[model samples]
Target chain A: MSATQSRPEPKQDEVYSALASARRPKPPGRLSMCLTFGWRGMLKIKHVPEQLIDVTLTPVLFLLMFTYLFGGALAGSTSEYLQYLLPGMLVQSVLFTSVYSGVALNADSTKGVIDRFRSMPVWRPAPLAGAVLGDSVRYLVAAVVVVVLGLIMGFDPGSVTGVVAAIALIVVFSFALSWIFTTVGLLLRAPQAVMNAGFMGLFPLIFLSNIFVDPATLPGWLEAFVHVNPVSHLTTATRGLMGDGASAWEIGRVLLEAAALAAIFAPLTVRLYRKAS
Target chain B: MSAQLAIEAVGLVKTFGATRAVDGVDLAVPRGAVYGVLGPNGAGKTTTIRMLATLLRPDAGSAKVLGRDVVAQADEVRSLVSLTGQLASVDEDLTGRENLVLLARLLGFTRADAKARADELLEAFGLADAAGRQVKNFSGGMRRRLDIAASIVVTPELMFLDEPTTGLDPRSRNQVWDIVRALVAQGTTVLLCTQYLDEADQLAERIAVIDRGRVIAEGTPAQLKASVGQGALHVRLLDADRRDEAEQLLARALDAQVHLEPDPARLTVPVTDAGRATGAIAELSAAGIELADFALGQPSLDEVFLALTGHPAEETVDEEEAA
Candidate 1:
């Protein structure tokens, strides 16, 4: 051996500086962060099964209420209208369920759960990313259960495969939406105020979308507003995927719109979450 | 021979708006010695420990734990040190064994190693029987034991305990003391922050008495006690209105100077131990000084704390002060 010695090779962990990395580590093939967080959230659900009372009943109730109350004026036949409204109701229920992201974060803080985690040596982002990953499961299951129930009640859209695609699309969009509120939850000091903001700001976003009526059927200005709405794109995408005849362009626009929503809100929520207490 | 320094902090400062939680301060702890930060609540002891533990950033100065810079090498420092904060709790949903096992996993132990560590800690902390019981059912002392055990799952080289016995009952406090001694025996350097002087006296190799974010006095317990002893006796008068009569009489009788309150019944004369105490009492009685109760004393840490704060030794701890 030579008298002079060179530096030793760096370990796998030294591959990248965490500070320099733009995104958090998703280490290849260990435990996908998605599963770890997903498991934790699922455990909480098993303990408090009562949380399901809303997701199971809300969509069915809303579909019936609208089909019976406003279906005559809107669509003439209640059956034809549900095929249209059920797709939108699926989107609404998934979106509404996403608000729990903030509620869960707030509860953890109030209960000193987050403080306990802070003292522990786990990855700072793991608990957060895990919560999001876990909630995806809840949203996906809710979307599927609601649609399966709708299918049994003669709310047929098209092929089984096509209906599956629509549910999958709604699940992806809802996961993206929940991250936005998770950040909102992180920034808002109190869960009560955050829930109030949801009731106020979120209520309008849901109603203003094309969930209740077709954009062309509305007043000219309102139709223009509805046509440009991102939620409209999601609703349109879901309706197309579930319907018998929908073009590639219609599906493409839905995906493109969904991507744009993710682009705008994903980074905004990350920034808000970092600044959260 | 140079002893390894477990912790070194200098000019560390942190300000929350206008209030300086930890003002400019310096700390040095030798490896394998128990160092105590003795102070009342809000004297910046907890903030100082937080900065050292790498949980809170300091606005100024720097710290090194096991030669790792706290800010620059925080992860490395964290790996070497474990902190049991006052607010920590065992996971209420998880069994006590699971809590320790989970901590072991986070510290990079394998399943077998984690379980072994969990079992060892459970027995050490007297939680063997309650190991499988959910932490929610455990009493306050059992939870505290589990929390401390969890912090040391990796057998950290340096440990920080912040007021670990603040609200504990006497027996429970002794149980905590046993665990703390066991860690020190294993050569873990411990820096304990406590407002209770008795804890410092019992556990620390050296103590620093802090007040209003500054070190007012620091040394071994015996050294500090010696500094404030002036060979004196203190007598409390029974009647609040006892005026100058006692002081005048004792001064004339003792031939040594005597001082008393502006009251009539009390007088303090020079003294050392109980032998000198007997002589002073005999002199007081001979002089016809009507004393109610008299006790010979050297200043305790209580008096030392009162001296630094410029307030009476016995005053209600105002709620706002703790906040």
Candidate 2:
């Protein structure tokens, strides 16, 4: 290196030759592309492990506070409330965690990496699908925290298989719900805006549903709203799976709602994403 | 016809809420050479590039990138072109190596091949040492080098370098120039958008000077410079107080308007005859004004813009607010 320059000369000739000799490989299948983006999301978590703090802390605090503070007053005993409140807590925790899907998308868009991904020849929905897939892992983490804490606090389920089924149902529902937030993310310009809107919309659905108390305990008008709330259906379905058993019709309705959300918002998110810039 | 040209955009228009950022801009960039799109800030350079790259849909008109319609065959166009944006497009949270690997994997490389290519690019760009470090912590130069490396992980027929060296130091800028030259040498057509005149003069064989969403002038660097004047006479004064006196004296002696530079001690006069310039220097000497430096050189791209647009190249216009 000369005194005029501090850095080494870039190996330009070698770079050109490498580019010249290399062949463009076959583009990956859609699934692989989505998974690669999922891997990217996981890498972000690895670099900043604090991304999981909300997933862990939210459930712990919500579960403990709801079960102890209001449990005796509502259900006659903390242990009785734990059995009912734990299933609803799983729904609330996973849905709350789903808000990050939109926040992360907004962050990516603002950072300009979304341009890089969009300009590439990969599947159009791969990035969005992969991000939600990555977030499913967080949903699983939240479920695990809630379930494990419930058991230690004296909540019991009918069977281990039932608990597994219940966790799987909630995770799938959260995955579907994440697309709605991703659409919100694409519509808003800032991550903070997306987070705010996501939670503001969710607070009513989470608190006004059967998560912490029975919908029957409410007035007729409020109960009607809770009965129709998708979060309430998801919570009830989760409770049935983890407790005695839920009806096929009840489980089917939740799956239909999840599917409908994915069907509507996935395409909506992709459209907004394509038109974003 | 499109085979010989890497990009052909005609009357492309893009408006953002009443602001026509790119208005009827047309471009024909030939293959295997650096085609410079030179403009100042908010001159619709980025917007025009975005429309051509298929990142933003044009409000009207059409574009063909590498002989394929950009809108109709966007996937094919994406397959054949890559854009290194003005902003660092790589993931800041990921390590330099991880960003490259991620792009490579997205480009269809196998797991092993992606790592190998990432390593090769990091080494070639002189970023081997910082490969493991997060990109957010890298210097502007390092981030720029990594961004370019990310673009070339799998080479395309054409590359869009948007202000690639905008804020880099001279050494890093030179390194980027070298990398760009290498890419062109290997048959990669580069559409380089830059505000720096010399960067265009050094790298581009043909230059398009766009101002306010239109191509005001298009020619080779020499032709564009010649359009303004044959040459410029630059004079630096020993005493800053005598600049106005020198400006008037030179304007009278040389029979041309003197352009005052931002430096109070310096002024430039566009000159066509060397004999008249010498007479102006003598006129300055007769006035007892000492000279620090004087040189007659080809009109730079800045002067060309000043001549064509009635304003200097550094003068930003209303388009910036929309941008």
The per-candidate TM-score of the B chain, in the order shown, comes to 0.83, 0.89
**Residue pairs in clash, model 1:** A37-A130, A38-A134, B231-B271, B242-B263, B242-B264, B243-B263, B243-B264
Per-residue lDDT tens digits for candidate 1, residues B104-154, read 655556568668777766765667777877677776677777787776666
Clashing residue pairs for model 2? none
Off by more than 4 A, model 1: A1-37, A54-64, A110-121, A245-277, B1-3, B93-95, B110-120, B128-137, B227-302, B309-323
* CAPRI accuracy category, model 2: medium
What DockQ does model 1 achieve?
A: 0.09
Per-candidate TM-scores read 0.80, 0.94
Off by over 4 Å in 2: A1-9, B230-249, B260-267, B272-279, B292-302, B314-323
- Please report the candidate that would top TM-score against the real structure: 2
lDDT of 2 by residue, A46-77 (tens): 88779899889989999999899999999999
